[model samples]
Target: MPFYIRARTYFKYAEEQMSLAEKEKDPEKILKFTLEAAERAVRALWAIVQVEAPKEKPPLEKILAEIDKACEPDLAEEIKNHVRRIKELAQNPSVEAAKEALILSRQVVRRTREVLEPIIGPAKRVDQHRRFYF
Candidate 1:
């Protein structure tokens, strides 16, 4: 599939996972879903730029550094910082961390969707009646 399509897929999944993360009571499960949302959001960002994202959970800072080193123009500082915060919060999952993760994931995913919409078309009218309300 094309990078745009992949980006949309990840963006959708990340949003779905975020919903689960929000209602979760267990810290581990919260972290699991939070990390998934964060990683998938990062993947969407990479795909929007037509590049491959890391499959492993190496430090997000390392991955961002690699992107900065390789991509012609790095992702906006806003995205980089959000992703870094996500990684930091994921380390020690707790009620507070989960709250922060949800906030961070929401911002990053919303921004990714905005940046991708013009290139790949708006996500408002997607199939299956599934909406991504960032």
Candidate 2:
């Protein structure tokens, strides 16, 4: 599968997990789902970066460094900070931590899309009035 497709799949899973976490009454379940969602979002960002630079499957640290160079300094720093915080939250789960993870996951996904749009062009749109003549 293509990198973008993989990224989309992971992003979708992250969104689903976040939704599940929101509805969950049990704190433990919420934490579990939120953490998973955060992790998946990170993976999606990784895949997006991979699509931008496809020479070799470099180590994650190297890939992150490449992404840092490719993106604005503030955006790169935000992503790095989010990843670090998400990992820390994973280690010690809490309702607040889960919420933070979900928020950061969303930020990462938005940033990734911003970075990818230029390289991949805009995403396709479906319209009811549009028809294929061919």
Best lDDT goes to which candidate?
A: 1
lDDT at position 29, candidate 2? 75
Model 2: per-residue Cα lDDT over 79-121, one tens digit each: 7787677767778777787777667766775676566665444
TM-score of each: 0.68, 0.61
In terms of TM-score, the best-performing candidate is 1
* Model 1 per-residue lDDT at 77: 66
The predictions' CA RMSDs to the true structure, in order, are 5.7, 5.3
- Alpha-carbon RMSD, candidate 1: 5.7
Total clashes in model 1, counting residue pairs 3 or more apart in sequence or in different chains: 0
**Model 1 per-residue lDDT tens digits across residues 1-134:** 67677777878888888889888898778877877887777766666665555466455555565544323344456667877777777788788887887787777667666766665466655743675577
